[model samples]
Target: NYNVLEQVYDVTKFLEDHPGGDEVLLSATGKDATDDFEDVGHSSTARAMMDEFYVGDIDTATIPANVKYTPPKQPHYNQDKTPEFIIKLLQFLVPLIILAVAVGVRFYTKSPSA
Candidate 1:
C-alpha cells in the first residue's frame, strides 16, 4: 500500500498537468498523505488503487489501463541480413582483388621489350 515507485510515477505524471506546478507533488512523495486525505473525495479509492501496485512477486507493477499495454514483438533473428551483407561484400571484393593481382603479375611478367 505504501510502495513509493507508483506514487513517484503518479506524481511525475500529475506534475505535467498541474496548473500550480509540482512542489506539492514533490513534497507528497516523501510524507504520508494523511492531512490531505479528506480534501479529495476518493481517498479510499486512491489508497485501494495504490495497494494494487504492490506486486510482491514482481519488481514492476502491471501496466495501468490508461497506458495502452503492448508486449514487445520477439526479435526476428531469421530476418537478420548481416550474414548476407557480409557475404555479398566478400563476393564483390574477393574477385576484384584477385583480378588486380593477376593483372599486376601479367604486366610485370610480359617481355621487357614488348
Candidate 2:
C-alpha cells in the first residue's frame, strides 16, 4: 500500500510495471510517498493512470504517531549575514534616496520665486 496526499493506492500489481523498479515502490510502503512521487515529476498520463490503482483515503486515526511522514531536514547555512544584509539594504535605500532627492529637487524648482 502506498499513501500519497492522504489517499491510499494499492500498487501491488503495478510493482513489475514501475519504470524505476519495484524496489522504489516497495521502499515507499507503510509511509507517505507524496514527496517521492512528486520528485519523479511523473507525466500527466502517468498521473492519470494512478487513478486505476486508487484504493481509498487513509484513516489518519489508524496511523501511528511515529509512522507519520516527516519531511527531510534542510541544511543550515551561515547565520552571520550582516554584510550581505547591509549590502541589500543599501541597494534598496540608495535607489529610494535618489528618487526622493529627485522629487524634492523637482518640487523646489517648480515653486514660484518669492
Task: Tell me, by TM-score, which candidate is best.
Answer: 2
Candidate 2: worst 10 consecutive residues by lDDT? 59-68
Clashing pairs in 1: none
Residue-level lDDT tens digits of model 2 in 2-104? 5434888999999999999999999999788999999999999999999999998976766666766799998877646668978988898999999999999
Residue ranges of candidate 2 with Cα displaced over 4 Å? 1-5, 66-114
In candidate 1, which residue ranges exceed 4 Å CA deviation?
1-81
lDDT of 1 at 112: 82
lDDT of 1 by residue, 1-114 (tens): 333342323445456655446775567764445465456555565667555434333223353427776999987676346889789888999999999999999999998884
**How many pairs in model 2 have backbone atoms within 3 A of each other, for residues 3 or more apart or on separate chains, i.e. clashes?**
0
Reference-based TM-score, model 2:
0.51
C-alpha RMSD in Å of predicted model 2 compared with the true structure: 13.2
Candidate 2, residue 57: Cα displacement in angstroms equals 0.5
